[model samples]
Target: MMRSGLLLFFIGLAACSPPVTKSKAKIEEFRQYLEKSRTDDGVLLESRMLAGSNGLVWENSGKYQGDILLDDSQLEDLVADFAGVSNDNNRNAFVVANTRWPNNVMIFNYASNEFNNAQQNAIRTAMSWIEHFSCVRFRWRSNERVFVRMTGNPTGCYAHVGFSTAHPNRVLNLARNNHCFSHGVIIHELLHSLGFQHMHQTYERDSFVRINWNNIISGQEFAFTRFPRNQVNLHGLPYEYTSIMHYHNQAFSRNRQPTIVPLRSFSGTMGQMEQTSYWDWLRLRRHYNCPGAWNRNSEEIMKKEVERTLPLIKLNLPAPKQGLFTDEDNAYVRALNADTNNEDIVNEEAMDYEDSDNENNNFNEDIGNDNYEN
Candidate 1:
């Protein structure tokens, strides 16, 4: 009887399963999910409907990938900052940052024992960069169960690199023994954490070489950009790359070399006090808007600020249309749709498996299965 039931199940599956087809909406959604998933491993699953995209699988891999580490006090501090914005428009814009940070911010180096003074200083410097420019706050937590281990290089050193559960937030310069190490990398990664895609080399206007945006893998583009037309206002003012939230690398040239001068040349090392950019100040002010003089519990006020500001943040890319099937270009749309849907269902089940208890022990085994639907 058990054998007969199993044979019947197989027959049913064979009859129901269809072939793959082109789905433009699914493809575009897959692309967006791929872009957002790179920010952090945890939220990758939440970002898209793709069954087998690498970003989705990577997200389900149980690794913590965010930069902002928040403890109870820090969370309160951030909440208080949003409470201070007076203008309803500005306050609405501010709340977007608040909603994005807590769950989006993954914890790293939660225990003091995990880092030394220099490492702590590195973390502080990275945090300072985000705070001063990005208007985001960092905090520490006591929980280890939620923490994900960094793979690749392990010398038991925890200060290698840090990012958001979504993107690179703050990377520790464990590679640099001297204090003169570049904070630009941390800044660069932080921009990625914030959902900016790399600029195309052909479109760049500065002395810096533009990134080959086309070269970016389909899903990874969001790591370096705001949507093409999306204009994000850092504070009450307009946003600009000079605001310190921009990526700094070898500038545009026939031959690639560092085009922009190091920030340290104008200022000092991480310890040296530096003047904040206008945009930076505005970002902080917007982020921490409160009703009173201090505006400590301004979460509601900040929410209003974000709601207003979101419209201003425009994406350069065209709005994606739903139900646009890619694989069906000249082929039968019905057949293609059936195939894609079948693949999507299988991929979803696989993702569920990857997210379960067997993840760590079965990572290698699962990676092969993950590449199937992509």
Candidate 2:
């Protein structure tokens, strides 16, 4: 009986061991993967591809029109960031179905044959950097519609940036050599897709012009631009030197003469960094409703932002009372009343005079007739 009891206990222990060990191993593997893949403090890597099943269709309607080509590796980089996956296996599994999403991005690229290696790399880098903060996608076209002719038009008007209500595609001038290394231009154009207007009027203007957030940010525009106006509640973006979106060349000249500085010196001229700002990250995180990856102070800062924007939201909303009038309105009403009273008095006086005149005329006639009879 003792031997039989011991045998039963050993069989039960053996039955539980495999399942427990397997689950523990699986958890350990997952934990290791998380540690390696985590970026920006466990924030998932995020980005979308530019192409879709039907492929890119072109119409000769808008400015900065051209074909877009997407880089797969860059797309992978963005996915790694979105998934927060350090393990190669996990990332592959997540993105296997699709690299692009319906709402995330619209990629614009040219055919592989048309673009050289340098231009391709530049596009990839620019897209990757932008994807770090925003949930935008890419749209690559097979045929090249717009060509950048350096000799014919050195400024390359073909490479244009524009946004519209119907199809919001960011047009990149891939033909221009100037834009080849221009990450800032790429980001600036992308911001337009996200509903940001130009920071300064012309490229000739100084880059350091201060932005008044209250004056510029509107809910209507925000909705149109597809950016989270609520998330962009800060006064201004931080001055980041390393931000890829910063102006490439300083507008200031040592000779005290206005000159078009190269894109490389744009940030130095502006006295800001070439990298993305803290405000930029904040806006992206809020717009996407991303999980908490920002610093502990971020919560406090976001709370303040919410408070700061409450008044603006209220200002945009229609007032509850419909018939309420202001002091100016009251003054106008009083003036109109006074004018009406004056007109009434003048009419009354005119009527009284007419009656008196009629009575006088009859008396004059009677006196004249009696004199004649005498």
Candidate 3:
């Protein structure tokens, strides 16, 4: 009788298993849909330069603040803020409420040929670093409806600010052979995709550092634009000069002179991309509402918290009501251009990110053209 009961249990488990053929078909269907969604119909709303380790890198015509690809409504909100017409002072962490990745998880996919093995490893290393410090987790794409598609376009490194609602399938381009594969650069671009903006762009930045506009390159001034205080939630933490997201002293300089001068003397390096500073990691944890993120050994504590909440995941516990220093529940940020009718410009390719070994031989030929320009 016991043998018969065990047999029945095993049979029940097999019956409950999902059909393999149907799953493969569904995945293939999504791949076809993604291919059809690729287009070049987007407008060149804004562009900004970034000071990577290889010196000043120009922005692609369609990017904002160096590499952020903004969608329609986000662009509208930013335009209004830029025009000094916006009265909506929602102080969430300079991020759109809905832009946060659901469940603090990030789903990603990349073409096999877009990046070489070293670059791919760098991407994983950066993701691992974030995972080690915060509650944010990364997973290679399966059948996720919304995910970041990393490309190896030679257009300099850039990413959409977050999970774009207007373009659910977003692309983050890390230009091949463009010095974009460094661990720090990978972390910087990944942070952008994770919805974090440049630290110097925060509204209260003027009090800490002075922007030397005269030293800035012409037509690149947009890169140094600031976010208004009302539009940003700083989490009451003091300005972080050592933030990985902070630009180097000579960022966007036309004459190799300093553009960002500190008002007060400080220890440590400014705009160091070596690793995410403590404050930088803290903001990310808070943004994701990671439990016990404020205390030491928080990462281990968070891991246990995740385990404890597994059975109760459906309950969706509430986040902290307000920040320790601020009066808001989350920080809110806004930006981009005002064009609403334009489509996105990323041309995403679909394939198994890990197993596929196709080589993009045409990548060199494709780089010579100025297709990335407006």
Candidate 4:
């Protein structure tokens, strides 16, 4: 009787199989699951320290293409592509159309007290570098509904691809724990937050360089996948060998072999995080539709704008209590005290500079010209 019951149970299960429509849905789900597993399983949860050919260091930020953070909609689009599902409308026709900030202003804040004076200066300097060629402006966060909140957490220096109305309060983390405070890395993350994708992953990349599949870390080959034409618009820019967004030859190499080999003879390094190339600036200008941005002096305009709007921001009343200090806190306090003491010294130096000859005060003339071969 027990054997008969078991046999009937098996027969009943076979008879109750899902219908054709349900089977099709189940197959799609399975395919999506496989794609997700394939893409995410190989991602390094811990940050990997990487150096460019120019000796500039950076850390891989997130799961998507190493550092690019994708929202749910974006991830779905990517997974669809991985599963060989063609999608014409992956949210917006152009990624920039909906992602670009209004009035070309990037309202932001030092979200945490983790950023030291030097780190803050480096962040500002990187933004200043972008401002030199584009109309994009950065400002201290105010009551604006949308803005970039920059925090120095131990989360490995990742940022959202661009501004989204749905994902307002966009975060751009510069990981203090990972030493992701370099000028170039900060600029790179800033570019990501500004809606730029990796240059090497452009759709036309195969013509420019060859990918050595054997050298790429197993399962991490997804990182080398090209962005489809619908996803990225190049705005008629030529394929640049020295784009800062281009990966170094040895990037993601398992055996330290060249993963990205240039087809054409190039004098400059593929990845130099030291500075943004001219093409970088040009693309940014075209993205923002601000060709007239280069007319103004960025430094003076930013200084004047900050001075005008800073005092208007309302201060927090009934300020929060001070928290307990860790060992790191003690070091931070020391640095803060030293910085406070240097204020007067810096003021005095500025006064001295005012009285000096213009020719002798060319110290900062090359401040924004800090570019390598890239």
Candidate 5:
């Protein structure tokens, strides 16, 4: 009877699956949101995206291939003080400080006009889920000096990564659409606001995944970045492919080919928006130092929910450097995209003059992104 029940459950999970789209609209919309809302130039930075699906497969935000969310103002003083470590070698020297909200609380105020009743309820529901899983608490603002201004801009979705003592009036923008309303997508952006970086940007990500430079859209190579060993801290957790923080495997693809290829073999899903994966909740707990916030019973329930709701991730990754294309192939893709074929070329010449600390902090505003659904 138990075996039959499990089989039936698995079959049900596979019933509704979303196919991958070509562009990164969620990411682009985040950028558009920042641009249109007159966010600080410090928050407005370079961005890239491919077509996306209404399904919760791919999501993007500017800086480090749509991973980290906050701009310079939202970063810690350490980042602002370091300013610039100019070139690639210098870039390696800078590590944006790992930041989290003090006292494990994130205060927010939604612009009354940005969301309708349904959208507002959806946002609150996402907040409740985060509160349910970890020690992190979300509260409405009464007079907190530092708080997030949740806006309903028509452009895209974005959030300040972590607590910003430097900039108290931080923003998390989600447009009115199926894209921003999906619980998983809301959770993803909220994680960013909570200071969680993208999974692929982990310092050790190179060991777990291989990035195909040639397959990425030309001149948008900055969309994919591997953090230096000392820059990012994972709170002692291993890489998690299913974290809400993960970008889709096909993110930043240029010719409908995957830019990031995993190295392990797993017959389960990689990116799913159904809910927070086990590792995601664990990391959130670790970062906030929230001991015993999530109990074993909660874990068991969520684990089953994830397995029963998400598609099985069937990953047959190639060994590193095995059957993987190289930077040399980027030349062809650049030409195909009508982009400069030179891999050596750096897109941001202005970046060369700026300090490394400020480079990845700018953010994009959200624009209308049709590639999302419930």
Candidate 6:
């Protein structure tokens, strides 16, 4: 009777196991992109993609910062390919899939128990910060094949950016040896999973800060490269230095010297992760189109915050290029432009944030661009 019971359990397991969705092998252009991307370490490894800027550094699959499971291409490379392609079908070859999670809901599971009790709690609290400010929600899995798999490994913490319906499910690893358990560190990794990039390397960053090549570690210089403009849609935001996503002033330092210095003389901490900055919440709210953003009663309060934020450093983008926008893109731009100048709206309002009680407020059109100030 015991043997029969065991046999029944085995059959049930087989019946419920989800089948992997079949996808074709990598495209030839992707192959070439990888070939062009070779580093001294050889082909860019599968996992250690930098959190953003198309990830310039290469690490073994065991290590990484990129959020996409597959490697991301530099904007220049993608733009070049786009210009050369006359065949409409080939256009799909370079298409950047929609990386946002479905319905602003993130489903996840644990793949490893390497996290100490504190580390586990760190992960939970980080998720709370996201929920505290935006409409996004995090849920544990229950027979959900499409979900994030949090793992505690010896390798550095890294995550595949965004949701992948085509190949759902991925690992978000935190190394035990690394300070991956810190509240800010854990929050940084989670933001990548939610589709954010390093604050410093976003496009049009030159106007805000200066990158000191002489101070960066020799081989790791590529880590400081800036992303191209127009690739990342800011949704009408301006550059910000206080964002939790910004890099530390001494990051990747070979001699403990500053690698990034602000162009203007502003005094404040840089690359901090203790908690999300005020603008961080605004960007999160705007990016996901958080349903109810600010209470109308708070409009005057928001205006004050806007006045305080407007004079800060910012990188203003030119109007969208003609012929570049899709129909949907065109519509989004039209409505957004119809509202007001990106910086003006950000400075004028957008301070109101939703609480757990589900406060209803108008989307303030507050804005901020990703920025680095380490």
TM-score of each: 0.32, 0.33, 0.61, 0.64, 0.61, 0.57
Q: What is the lDDT of residue 222 in candidate 5?
A: 41
Give candidate 5's TM-score.
0.61
Model 4 per-residue lDDT tens digits across residues 151-198 = 654546667666677668677876654246555677777877777767
Please, what are the lDDT tens digits per residue for candidate 1 over residues 71-103? Answer: 233233222322331233542342233223343
How well is each residue in 60-117 modelled by candidate 3, as lDDT tens digits?
3234555566554555444334333443444232223456677778889987666665
Q: Pick the winner on lDDT between candidates 2 and 5.
A: 5
Clashes of 5: 40
Residues 1-374, candidate 6, lDDT per residue (tens digit)? 01100001000011111323322342354334433433223222223334322212212232221222333333333333323333324333423455567788889888444454445545665675566445677898998777888875443456665566755766576654324545556666676677676666665568888888897755455445454342344444557776667777766665767778888765567776555565665566565665323333222323334344332211111111221112323332233334333433333322322222121111111111112111
**Model 6 stretches with alpha carbons more than 4 Å out:** 1-96, 112-114, 293-374
List the lowest-lDDT window of 10 residues for candidate 5. Answer: 3-12
Choose the strongest candidate by TM-score.
4
Candidate 3 regions with alpha-carbon error over 4 angstroms: 1-62, 80-96, 295-374
In terms of lDDT, model 1 sits at 0.28
For model 2, residues 1-374, the per-residue Cα lDDT tens digits are 01100001000011111122235454555334333322122211111012111101111101211111112332343233333443445433432322122344453555444444444444554454444333343556445342211111122212222222222333444223332234444444444334332222212223434323233212111101111122122222343333323322222222323222333333333323233344554544443333332333443443333343233222221111111112223322233224232322212211112221121222212211211110
Better of 1 and 5 by lDDT: 5
Question: What number of clashing residue pairs does each candidate have, in the order they appear?
Answer: 62, 46, 10, 0, 40, 13
In terms of lDDT, which candidate is stronger, 1 or 6? Answer: 6
Off by over 4 Å in 1: 1-113, 125-139, 143-231, 249-276, 290-374
Better of 4 and 5 by lDDT: 4
Candidate 5 lDDT (Cα, 0 to 1): 0.50
Looking at model 6, how many pairs of residues clash?
Answer: 13
